[model samples]
Target: MSCLFSPIKLREETLANRIVMSPMCQYMAKEDGFATGWHLVHLASRAVGGVGLVLVEATAVEPRGRISDGDLGLWSDNHIKPLERIVKAVHDLGGKIGIQLAHAGRKSESRAGIPVAPSPIPFDEGYRTPHELSEGEIQEIQERFAEAAQRALRAGFDVIEVHAAHGYLISEFLSPAANKRTDRYGGSTENRARFLRETINAVRSVWPKERPLFVRISASDYTLDCMTLEETLRLLGCLKSEAVDVWDISSGGIVPTGLQPVAIGAYPGYQIPYASRIKRELGLITMAVGLISSPELAEYTLQAGNADLIALGRELLRNPYWPLSAASALGEEIPWPKPYERAK
Candidate 1:
């Protein structure tokens, strides 16, 4: 059997294969941040298409944390039922499902209210300067993350991934370029990592230890003043006690377009090296993502131990059934949905 088709267990959750549908924002939620039918169909299709694990998009932990007014949220109890529907649909289809809990912070484009960040810096000239988060407010945000994790557990998700990547709230704290605070939450790398460390601890308080917790991080900020691969390693080392089960590695987005790393899609498997190195050095499981589309490439990555799991974003969007086709291409006999078995 191809490595890609092999099952792997993380905590108590055992995925059918190494194929993961990386969370991609749909931007189709109701203004109140409720999941709509579009989200159910979007995520369920991938499960039906045989994705081993389907991850819901970056869901906002609070109203103002939304990337847009239409982003899904878990801030309120009302949001749970709609998300639970999606979870049930995916589980019934025999696929594991996860949700990426996020806070957009300075990157929030939602017209709800002012954005908040570790500093008052704007993401770019076009964006407004985000209000610097007070120490009290920072604690509140961490509580919000914990509250959201409780909602995720109530919704019955198999995994919960914290979105600390791509210049969002937690990412802002990690990047020196975005965080200019002199407080304990800034200055040294250990200081900057404090927010993330505490945030993960908060989530872990509510999220079950038996279930896995994943953290998505931008391994490199692609700018000298921001995080480098070595700095990222230090940051992860600081988080060692959190017991994060997997590091879903991706890079850049700490700075604006020109200042960030070149577009990740410029080369296939462009971000694999970051994941590979993190796994090798830190001895942590990682999910490699970014422009990894072909079955051959995904299979090679697993066979070579580059990453524990292969996460696909745009490729899954282009073909929800990419996993089904990929199994055929690699000569792995994965099961297809009974309705599609005739065609297979």
Candidate 2:
């Protein structure tokens, strides 16, 4: 059997293969961040096409954390129905589904309503400077994450990923550059990591012990004052103690526009070394992401012991069948949908 097609047991959920469909925002949610028919069809088709794991996009733990007004949300019980449908559809097709629970931090852009964050930083020119969340409000937001996680449980999701990267709320708190307060939730690395740790603990408490808990973090700040590889290692080391099953390594996003680096400069698997380092250093399973599209590259990454799981973002977006096609291209027999057997 091809190693890529081998089963991976995360917590109690066993994935059929290592190819994970990274979450990409569709910005097509309804007014309440509820999944529309667009999400249902878009996510389900990938499972039908033969992805081992299809993770839904950055779902907000609160309305204010949405990257846009139309982003998917799990902030309320009402949000569960739409999500349950998506999860059921994916699983019914013999694939596992996970949800990326996120809070877009200072990156929150005004769309359906007012924007808010850990600081009043604006995502870009003309974007509203978000309302810096107060400490009490921060605690409340953690409660919201717990609530959303419970709703995810009700929605029948197999795994829950706390989205801490990509200039989001948790990311904001983690970045010393973004989090500029003298309070308990800011300043030192432990303090900066406090919010994310609390949020993770909150979600994990409600999330079934048998189910896996994943956290996506920027492996490097790619800028000064932002979290670095050393800090990330410390954070990942701490997170492992809290029972985080996988660390999805994707870099950048803490700094403001001028400091951010474009993806072009990084080589294929540019961030794999971070995943490898964390895995070796922290002794935890890690998922390598960022610009990994080809089957050979993905296999090479895994074979090199850089990551235990390979997450494909834009590649999967351009071709939802990338995994199945990759399996075929690599001489591995990936099962096709019964109806699409001849096509496969």
Top-lDDT structure, candidate number: 1
Candidate 2, residue 220: how far the Cα is off, in Å: 1.0
Quote each prediction's TM-score.
0.98, 0.95
Q: Tens digit of lDDT per residue, candidate 2, span 237-259? A: 65566468888988887766565
CA lDDT of each candidate?
A: 0.93, 0.84
| Candidate 1 lDDT | 0.93
lDDT by residue (tens digit), candidate 1, 1-344: 99999999998899999999999998899988999999999999999888899999999999999999989999999999999999999999999999999999999999989999999989999898999999999999999999999999999999999999999999999999899999999999999999999999999988998999999999998876578889999999888864699899998887887756444445999999999999999888999999999999999998889899999999999999999999999998888888888898
TM-score of candidate 1 on Cα atoms, chains taken together: 0.98
lDDT, candidate 1, residue 249?
A: 98
Q: Where's the lowest-lDDT run of ten residues in candidate 1? A: 257-266
